[model samples]
Target: MNRVDTAVHVEGLRKRYGDTIAVDGIGFDIDPGQVFCLLGPNGAGKTTTIECLEGYRRPDAGSIRVLGLDPLADHGELRRRIGVQLQEASLPARLKVWEILKLFSVLYEREKVPWSLLDHLGLEEKRDAYFDKLSGGQKQRLFVALALINEPEVVFLDEITTGLDPRARHAIWDLIRGIKEGGATVVLSTHFMEEAEALADRVAILRAGKIVANDTPEALMRSIQRDDEVRVHVEGSLDAAAIEAIEGVATASIDGDQLIARGVGRGWIARLVNGIEAQDASLLDLSTRRASLEDVYLALTGEDEYSPESPATEEAGT
Candidate 1:
């Protein structure tokens, strides 16, 4: 890929609170117009790293530049150019949707795109509703709309769809894509593996306050060395010798009546079918699949879920 102008850049970023170190020397870059995802389990410092980039918190050690300006030193200039949707955003309970958007718009020198932004976020009809009256998903949409009112050059979305249902989540994902297409860079921190895989151009996986893996989703999936597993259901019992004769068959195992074969690539399915047909055995069903990002996460971090067990453990473990 060509080296585009860097929208956000970090080098050896570190942060600590008293005795606990939250972020430990992490570094990455986001190119212009790219959807860069900071992925990790809870307490992995993904939020802290994002806070540093957003100028919400200062780093103890390291450098951060967003849109060619230092985030900490130039926070005034940086805030004008970036929009942030915090993980736990709150508005006055009685504030109307339009009131909140209009209030935020006044903070920026540029005029807020309230009308188009509200329409795009599906908030046009809810303009008169108070913040407390809206549902979780609707509130999330309103928060996103507020973030984009200023037409920022870079948008930081920290788990923007955490409480949304599947339909609402997909809608927000499409809105995010539209944001990227409109020439703004996006830096999102998410725990959902599918969300990262579906949207991120490149992902940085953080664990224990450090980066464990960083690459495109496809590249990260291919990095795992487990041979692809193909399941073949034969009509009748097949001898082990016949299964071994199939091309690209690394190993074959019989689970009850089904034949499970592990192989390297795509041709294994055809080869297995041909081998079975030659033996006068009918093939019942066959399926081939590769590993997903969830598998990759388990293999690397050894965690089944992203949430931490306890706050005390989270602070102590890191």
Candidate 2:
């Protein structure tokens, strides 16, 4: 892709600390108005890569361009055009949310209305709350609002939803969608499989400081041939043979009060429902799970869901 047309461009990117290579000669281009995500486990170099792109850390090697400007050489110009919400952000403890937003807006040449942003982020009620008094999710929203105070062309969000409740996380996801809808290119780093799947237009999965896979969530899942599963709770007996007889079903079994079917192809849920309806059993609850970004992450990185249980820290080289 042409670098000039891209919102963010990186080529042969490398960063090292002592003997450890935090980012290993990686390269990718992000298009304008796209939601690009860096996904991996803790210490997989997601934070390091983001820091380099944000001009906070100078890369040991390679070139990076945000909004067609070098992040390091044109730090001042780039800062104005790009917004960042770091993995860990800080502000004066006594500062109120409105005060923080106003403070950041003064630094930008083109300022967005602070109250509008607070309203959009659902922080209108917390407008006067002190930074130290806000809950984790509220603080996250405030950080995001500050990131947008500049009306930036590109935004970088690193692990923005970590440790938040499900409702808050989903709300953050909606905010991300709104950011993209507003025409800002978003580069976010996350280890949460669902977050990447839900928000990323394209995902670059890093493992051991290098990109192992990069593609849209659907394409990545399609690249690997994983099976879909169907489960149904029935009021009466379920014939395992009847379910297994359905086309594409690899296996079927009755587990306690539920009928479970595993399949290699699509439309298994509809087929299973039809098959079950034909039987004497009454279907009570039914659900189907397809191959997800989590499956793709596990398959590509060779790491299980619980492998990297530790929280990411700067000292850990995340």
Candidate 3:
């Protein structure tokens, strides 16, 4: 593929801290004008890989290109073309909103006018508010504004919506959507399943320092057929033993009056019908739902749910 057609391209990227390997030979490509998400649990190296692409950390081995330029060897030129909102961002507590924006604007050769971000981010009322005085949501917006001051061709965000309430998180998602619409490639690392499902044009799921899964959310789910589930409703109790013995049944459970079974494929529906009939239970209703992204995550990593178990989830603290 023509490298210029891709926004970010990584191959055999590796990073380590002494004895600990953070990222291990990961590779992927991101298209321009798309929102790409890096997803994983704690210590999965999502942040490490993103930092390497942002030129914040050099890789121990392998290559990465952002906007068709080497992020490390071409630091100065790359910085001018890329934006970054780190997971843990802080500003001088005493500095007002506009003051910091002005500070960042002067650092770049070309940048959006300082006040324009205040208007664009709907922070005109807090233009003079001190950094410490702003609410969690407002501070996040300021960080985004700073990242955009340079009007970069690509942006990197680490845990963008961490610590935000539902309303605030939705607002940030909208802002990210708008950024993509405005023609900036956004690469974000997040643990939120909904965030990945909602925003990412494609997602890469990392685990144990390696790239385990990378694809569109729907494609990823469909790729893992065993995660699909079927729900059956019956007036009486289910024949738990017979259902459990059925072929393709990965797991079977009872929820209220429903007998839920997850199987290897849609063919499980046939196995389920046979099992139910042999038990003489009236199958009132049978329904099927495709595997979700969360299900795929659990299946690939064999870990807890993607969102709730991550340390980032605790950091969100909401």
In candidate 2, stretches whose alpha carbon ends up further than 4 angstroms from where it belongs are: 1-4, 86-89, 110-113, 234-239, 255-257, 267-285, 304-318
Clashes of 2: 0
Candidate 1 ranges beyond 4 A from true positions:
1-4, 87-89, 304-318
lDDT per residue, candidate 1, 10-84, as tens digits? 999999988878899998988999999987877788878888999989899999989989998899988878888
Worst 10 residues of 3 by lDDT: 309-318
TM-score of 1: 0.90
**Per-model lDDT:** 0.81, 0.85, 0.84
Candidate 2: residue 204 Cα off by (Å): 1.0
Cα distance off (Å), candidate 3, residue 302: 1.3
lDDT of 2 by residue, 197-280 (tens): 899999999998999999999999999887777788998888899889988889999988898889986676777888888888
Reference-based TM-score of each model? 0.90, 0.87, 0.80
Clashing pairs in 2: none
lDDT for residue 170 in candidate 1, whole number 0-100: 91
